[model samples]
Target chain A: MRSGAAVLVEALRQEKVDLLFAYPGGSVIPIFDALYDAPDIKLILPRHEQGGGHMADGYARACGRVGVVIATSGPGATNLVTALATANFDSVPLVAITGQVKTKLIGNDAFQEADITGITRPVTKHNFLVRNVDELGHCLTAAFHIARTGRPGPVLVDIPVDVSMAKTDVPLPTEVHLAGYRPHVEGNLRQIRIAAEAINQAQRPVIYAGGGIIISGASDLLRQLAEKSNCPVTTTLMGLGCFPGRSPLSLGMLGMHGTFYANYAIMESDLVVALGARFDDRITGDVTKFAPGARIIHVDIDPASISKNIKVDIPVVGDARLVLEKLVELVHFVERRDWLARIEGWKKKHPLTYSSGGLRPQYVIEQLDEAAPDDAIICTEVGQNQMWTAQYYKFKIPRTFVSSGGLGTMGYGLPAAIGAQLACPGRRVIDVAGDGSIQMNIQELATAVQNKLPVVVCILNNGHLGMVRQWQQLFYKSRYSGTILEGNPDFVKLAEAYGALGRRVTEAKDVRGALDEALASGRTYVLDFVVEPEENVFPMVPAGEAIDRMIGGMT
Target chain B: MTESKQVISAVVENRPGVLAHISGLFASRGYNIDSLAVGETENPLYSRITVVARGDEAILEQIRKQLAKVIDVIRVTELSGQNFVERDLMLIKVNAPAAKRGEILELAEVFEGKIVDIGVKHIMIEISGPEQKIEAFVELVRPYGIHELVRTGRVAMLRGVSGRPARAAESGEEKKSKN
Candidate 1:
């Protein structure tokens, strides 16, 4: 017989989880104690539960594996709520093992008791509460299976303290038997044929790929389908890097803050093959006017995602990679010179541009793109920095760009960078963060320093919530209410205090040098680049307006 | 695409938090559950949940799809347009003075309600019928000063179905055609 915590560790071993991002607390002492004896799984303690949760999410996104995070009951589990929601929105596979109070004291308001399972129901894909040690192994196995399977998202397992301490001899289940949980992997053959015919016949076809392509590891398949059909490809922000960003056929991104040519191409296209991409409001602009002349073929794993926003002409529900494999085989080559020429004209007329002066964020991103290694993974905090990185940085490979796309979580970058670095030890990891967003989870700097993960965080320090300020400037007559980041800490000193390398670069010429030096430091480094404050992202579609109605970026 | 009441029934794993998961999905998606009822099915491991919601065709499609996506939900069937039978159970307490006792009993007999309990000045009646009938009975008893009323939302099943109820999967094609 073994303790419940020992069985939990054994279950983790069975799942081949080598790295555990966890925070210790009162309810989880038994599990922590078990970890003391278990040397195979490395425990990287995070300063906060939320940071640890993001780390797990980042690890999952970086490597195609289920990330695991553990936290204690009550406040510790509650702290992970934001991270769970973020991962859920992005569909990242993560298993969060949280400690709960003893079963008998669960509803009696015992010390450190929390209804964590209740709190996380809507955010997580699934969750469990382990009532006994006999079922602990099964729950853990099920949690991991649910988290990593089709349409991957976070799953939480709350193990009561007494359950963890109880003795049990039941072996962990190797396979899950969930009758209600089978994901549709192979799409209907008729639907695939219909989609292929639509693709083959269209004069101007565009492939609008999203993060699902990367999640399903269908980037290569996506490229094949796009190339075979001679289609121009555009990606959403999360879908960046799933296709070669610098390719001639690439339309950088679509939706709000997308490239002028990409948006114009999508609007003008006769066929829009949406692969693993949802037509989000940010991308669709005014839904009634979106893709006015186009017949849409949407391919996704989730049936619900199809025709949820924009009406899909051909809906194929299956794994993206599997569907693309079949689609590439069926789709025939077609060339329309007039369509390509029109897109090229738009690209030349309204290229993504910024006024080149005073340490612009776009300039900084371009410099980082140029200076970083080809395979370096770039994580980003939300707001202007995220938009800038999406706009300026050319991600050549899949899994190289990571950001909180769905939830737009601000503090996601630093911890995510750490997780990415851990996942890809040989690759350089950098967090391109805005000053306001970086401060939200700055405490994770300690996690980076202690782990000796050489993650670089380049803060585009504008001393304000730049994105909100831009919206205020454009829509609210530049009142800038509560957008200013007053009394910001000196980031360089903050890095020094955390025993990490720090640099403050104020000039455009110095940006590349700082990035190079920081990448080579072999220590957690912080680069504070004081970028232009009032700069706004361009080719912007004001909310609820048509995609073609641009506010700026007309060269 | 006008808004109408939609009845959705799902077979789900009989687990601790399955109800919460289903209800939470509805609440988070901004779909109001007009009525909801859950009970164990013939199989002990599974429970049947019947939910009535008000939405247009698009909203109804979304609700069905979202409900099917939940891990615990085994199958989802929309019973609104199909030939189905639905009943809601209600236990209502009303003032039963000596003078009004005969009238109340007469009204109960008309509605096929059974007098479950009787107090000195109150009568407890149990009635099971379609939602409209329940509402009608409640309105009729209101003049008698209803003391308390509780209902077990609604439970529905398709008529002449032996194996399994027809799934809402066919509606996907219907939705596409309408679009």
Candidate 2:
């Protein structure tokens, strides 16, 4: 008879979990002991539980697999809240295992005991509390299955100390029999035909892609559909790399910090084909006025996201790639040269531009794009740096741009970059971060260096929280408040302290060279680009305004 | 925002935190839950949850689909437009003075409610029926001075063999007729 820990390990092995990001504690010693004997599963330790959780999220996003994280109960389990919410919001598949106090000690206010399953219920897609050793194997199996299936999300399984240590002869079930949960995968043929007819009849058509395209591995189908229909494409911040950024028909990203042409195309289009995108408030500014003239055709795997924001004329719920494969088959080529010319005119009239001299954040992102390897993964911390990277980085391939899009969590960059590097070994991974956001999880530098993962972190140090400062400047009468970072650490010295290569580039001309040198160092590097302090991300549709009312900069 | 009350009933797995998962879904989304009731179904392995929420058509639709999306939720059905029976159980303790005791008892009889307990200064009445009937009963006894009140929110079931069609046994004829 095997111990419960062995059965758990065997289940994870059956699920093909090769790597686990973990932080050990008193309650989880049994599982750690099992890991000691297991040769195939590798465990990478992080300094903080939060960092490890974000790393798992990054790994899942980069590899399109179920990322796993293990932590002790109470404080350790609570630390994973942010990452769990982040993965749930973005639909990334992650399985989080937290060790609770013994079953008998639970609810008695025992040390290191917390209701982890209850606390994480809302944040996680599904959560389980292991009360019995017999349920341990199945709980884990179900957790992994639920996390990676359908509209993927984070699942948490809280194992009490006794449950982990208890011996059991129960074997792992070959199949999970969740009677209530069966994900609908196939696209309804009637809806597909309706969408095809809409695409064929529309004169000015635009395809709006979201992160779901990348999640479903539908970039190829998206490109084919865009090319076949001769339609311009506008992607949400999460959908950045689903279509080639440099393509003539590509409008880059559309939303609060979207391109002028992209926002305009969405406004003017007669037919809007929304693919795998939830109509979130950020993207659909002033929902009543969003795409007012367009007959929207929304395709998503989750039925709830279809009419949650802007109502659609046609709703198709299915996997992105599957729906697109059938859609492309039914679609016929159509020409709209006049519509293309109008988009070209808009692009020429209001191109993304930044005045020279002080090292603009946009310019730094462009330089990083130039110096990075072809397969480099770009992760970003929130705020101006994230928007700049989304706006300026020319992502030609899918799964290369990873960021905390839906949750907009700060300090996600460094840990995510580490996870991405581990997911795609030998690949160059960079975390583009803002000055304020980088410090949120800067301690992960040690985690990166210790793990020998040569990931780069590019901090756009502007001595201020750029996005909030911009909002204060535009709407708050320039009252900066607590947005400014008056005293900041010397990032170069900080990187050195962490035993990672450090470089600072102040001049615009040296930005590219600094990035190149850092990448060539073959060590975990931190390149601090001291950018223009007061620069603002433009083509922004002010909150509560319609997308067509975008102002400033290119607009 | 044109808000209207929509009653939604869902059958979920009788597992720990399943109620929290459902209630949390509404709370996190900034959706208000006007009333909620949960109890075990005929099958001990499942529980039926009924939620009354006020929102526009879009918000109501979102709630239904989102509730259905939960892993443990087996089926979700909106009971607003359907021929469904809804009920709420309430126990009210009122100060029925010696002179007003007969009057309060008469009102309870009119409402088809029963006097469950008679204290020295107060009497407890038990009532279970549609919300409107309960509300009317409470209003009639309000003058007797209510000392305490407890309600079980709202629970609903479709008339006859009518509910959200089970995924496993979805027949063509079931789709043709509401029943």
Candidate 3:
């Protein structure tokens, strides 16, 4: 006979989870007791549940495996809400296990009792509340299956105290069977053929890639199709590394903060091959005017995402890698020399640039790129710093650029860097963070120091929520209401207090040296670069304007 | 184009929070559900849900795709424009004065409805029919002042020997519209 907690551990073993990020609390002692004896699964305890969740999210994004996290009931589960929502928005596959009150005390406001399944329902792709020991085996298996399959997202399995303590003899299921859950993996051949025909016939075409390319491991197929068709590619924020930044066919990222040439190419193209990317509002500013002349062929695994935002001429639904492989087979080669020249002209005329100032964010990012290894993983918190990393750093590898894309959660970088560092033991992991956003979960510094992860936290200390301040500067007549960080703590001192190396750089010339020092440090390091607060992300398509209607940049 | 009321039905696994997940998807998107019904299907492990929603064709199409994305949902079908049988059950109570009682009884009988209960000041009638017929009956009895009303949303079955999978008929609309 095996206990319910033992069944859960066996299920985790079957799923091949080598590590777990967790925070122990009242209701999860039984599960923790089971984990204590299982030396195969190393449990990394974070300072808080939120940190644990983001760590798991980062681990999943870096390794392409379903990351696991364990938290207790009540407040412990509630703390995971932001990270869960962030993972959901970014389509990261995660299995979050939360402790619950005993089945008898579930709804009676028992100690540490919270409706984790109900609380996490909206954020999670799917959730389960295990009420009995018999249901534990299938429930855990189903959670893992649902998490890692078809447009992946976080899933939660809540185990009650009594259920975990109950004993059962039923072995773990070999295969999960959910009567309602079946995901379509193969691309429909007919739709794929039609898409290929459209690609073959088009002269001025642009390939728009999104995060799904990375999730489905379709970067190689994407590069192959782009090279075959001679089509320039523009990726969304989540799809940075799908195409090499230095490739001639690459136009960098496309969105509000996209490069001028990339945005113009999308608007001017006759055919847009949108692969694995949702035409989000941020990407398609002024939806009515977005790609006005293009016949969009949108390929996504989720049918709902196909035409939800923009109307498409051809809709191919399947896994990104599988669909791209099919397209590579059916698509004919074409050389659009004229289109390439036009894009090159636009790129040369309106290049991404920043006026010289004291420690520009862009310059800092460029130096960080230079100081770090080619295979280093760069995680970022949301804001101006994140955009700068996306703009300046040249990512040539998949799963190297991890950030909160859909939810844009602040304070995601540090913990995520910890996860990435743990996942890749010898590689240098860095967190490009905004001063305003880093403080949101800065307490995770303790977790890093305690675990001896050599992650470098590069803080762009602008003393303001730089993105919002920029928006206020441009559209709100510089009113700057509640955007300024008036009494920010000294980040270097904060880092030192956490028992880590800390340094500050205010001059542009010193940026590289600071980064080098931090990278060379064998322990966790925090480098605060005080940047020009007013520097805005350029080639920006203002809200309610077409992507081509960019307002700022060199003429 | 004017909005049309569409009937959507889905087969889902009988699991906890599945209903909430389905309903929450609509609510979060600001799509109002005009009426809804849920009950166990022929299979003990599966349940069927029907939602009557009014929106333009584009919104309705989005709703179908989004509902189908739910993991617990086995299938989602829009039973509109196809040969199908649909029924709605409504229990409506109306104030009936001495002179208005006869007219109300006559109106209910014309719609093939029955007076299930009668109180001193009101009458309760149960009606079962298509949405249009129910609407017509409700309109005729409006003069009597409806005191209370409840409806079971549309439940539908396709015509005999013409069963088509949800995904098959769905592609027809996409091909017809070229979108």
Ranking by DockQ: 2, 3, 1
Model 2, TM vs. native: 0.95
lDDT of 3 by residue, A471-499 (tens): 99999999999999999998889899999
**Model 2 ranges off by over 4 Å:** B119-122, B162-179
Per-residue lDDT over A1-555 for candidate 2, one digit per residue giving the tens place of the 0 to 100 score: 788788889988999899989999988889999999987998989888999999999999999989999999899999999999999999999999999998989999999888888888878888889899998888888988889878899999899888888999988986787766777767889999999999999989999999989999999999999998888999998898899988999998998989888888988889999998998888888998888789999988888888878888999888899999999999988888899999999999988877777888888988888888767899999999999899899998888998999999998888998889899997889999998999999999999999888898899999998899999999999999999898899999999999999988889989888888888888999988988899998878999899989888853
Interface DockQ per candidate: 0.33, 0.37, 0.33
- Chain A TM value for model 2: 0.99
Candidate 3: list runs displaced more than 4 Å: B97-100, B161-179
- Assess the local accuracy of residue B170 in candidate 2 as a C-alpha lDDT between 0 and 100: 29
Alpha carbon lDDT at A136, candidate 1? 88
Show pairs that collide, candidate 2: none
The docking quality of candidate 3, as DockQ, is 0.33
Ranking by lDDT: 1, 3, 2
Write one digit per residue (lDDT tens) for candidate 1, span A455-477.
99999999889999999999999
The residue pairs that clash in candidate 1, if any, are none
